[model samples]
Target chain A: MTVKVQREDFDVGAELAAMTRGKTSIGGVTLFVGLVRDMAGGESVSAMTLEHYPGMTEKQLEAIEAEARARWPLDDALIIHRYGRLEPGDQIVLVATASAHREAAFESCHFLIDWLKTKAPFWKLEATPEGERWVEAKDSDDAAAARWANQDGDQKG
Target chain B: MKVLYFAWLRTKIGVAAETVDLPPEVKDVGGLVEWLKTRSPKHAEALANSKVVKVAVNQEHVPYDHPLSPGDEVALFPPVTGG
Candidate 1:
């Protein structure tokens, strides 16, 4: 698995290809790309700046990936998050998971992103008409992660 | 000890970092915050609201009770809003 926090753009296809390289056992790959939205909570966001703890960000991401691996039979996982200034329509994050079956790969990929939403140390500053404000955490994200927790017994390895 | 501030906290505090020798009784992040509240009127005002402030110990998210040792790095910021 590879987790990177960088200012440069990433190639999702290349990353997935490299992770799945030399692995014929993998039958499915699931990916998620999170983009910077132009509007948030009815406010127009002109630009956004992302900041994170340099050394601990990657460690937190790896721990999240480890939790996903414990729950699923994933072959590989990759997370790439961008830091620094970004505008609307810019790609903010990419999460990809591969496995021998589609179920584990898809579920684990979704789980990783959901967990990262709240658990990761990165923060966002949005520029609005009034002024720049730090975005607030959403209840919806907490609910999304709760759904996975409620399904503990039904998971199949 | 060195204290680092980031994001909205930095904006409110008006400085990115500072160094000070906290009292021996200020044993953790929460105690440190309470001590900071006494440093200046602005600090007391800025940290009075907990909903806007988040604390970290050595770059990791930590609760108020997280222990603090001499020379340890503590960071204060707002809750994350990243994607």
Candidate 2:
């Protein structure tokens, strides 16, 4: 498993190749990449700045990655989140999970992103036509994370 | 103790971090926040709504009733919105 918080962009192809280089047992890989949008809340967004709590951010991410591993029989997992100024269509984050079966890989990937949305300590501020505004936390995001709570029976190989 | 703020809380407070000597009565995160609000108007404005402001002690998320120590590191910020 790996977690990376950086300002530089990542190459999806290279990262995937490196992850599965010698892992012949892996049968499936699921990944998700978040991107900056040009429009938000009905306003035209020119740019976005991602702010994070540095030390605490890494610790929380590692904790959640560990949680994902405990609940899923997975071969590998990865989380890459970016920070700082970004324009529309810029990559913000990436989550990937690998397992012997497609079900485990797919479910774990969904769980990681759901948990990351609410538990991670990063914030986004968008520069709009009027001015910059901080993105508000959505209740829907919290609900998405909450659905996985108490789902102990969902754990599978 | 050291206190840190992030995002809008930092912007509203006009500072990112500060070192403060806690009062004897401040024994928990909630108490520390109440005391901090008394420090300045900006602090009061930033922390006016404690429900929206989340707190962490020593880089770990904790309840408002979580106990505090003299040398602890405290951070206050809003709910996370990342993916």
- Looking at the true structure's interface, with contacts defined as alpha carbon pairs within 8 Å between chains A and B, what fraction does model 2 recover? 0.88
Candidate 1 error regions (>4 Å): A146-157
Q: Give a tens-digit lDDT track for model 2, residues B1-83.
A: 99999999999999999999998999999999999999999999999999889999989888899999998999999998777
TM-score of each: 0.90, 0.97
Give per-residue CA lDDT, model 1, range B1-83, as digits (tens).
Answer: 99987776777778888998988899988889989989888788879987667887776678898899997888887766666
Isolated chain A: TM-score per model?
Answer: 0.92, 0.96
* Interface CA RMSD of each prediction in angstroms: 1.4, 0.7
Best by TM-score: 2
* Predicted candidate 1 versus true structure: per-residue lDDT over A36-60, tens digit per residue: 8999889999999998877767877
Residue-by-residue lDDT tens digits, candidate 2, A1-157: 9999999999999999988999999999999999999999999999999999999999989988999889899999999999999999999999999999999999999999998988889989899989999999998888778778747655321
Q: What fnat does each of the candidate structures reach? A: 0.65, 0.88
**Candidates, DockQ:** 0.62, 0.88
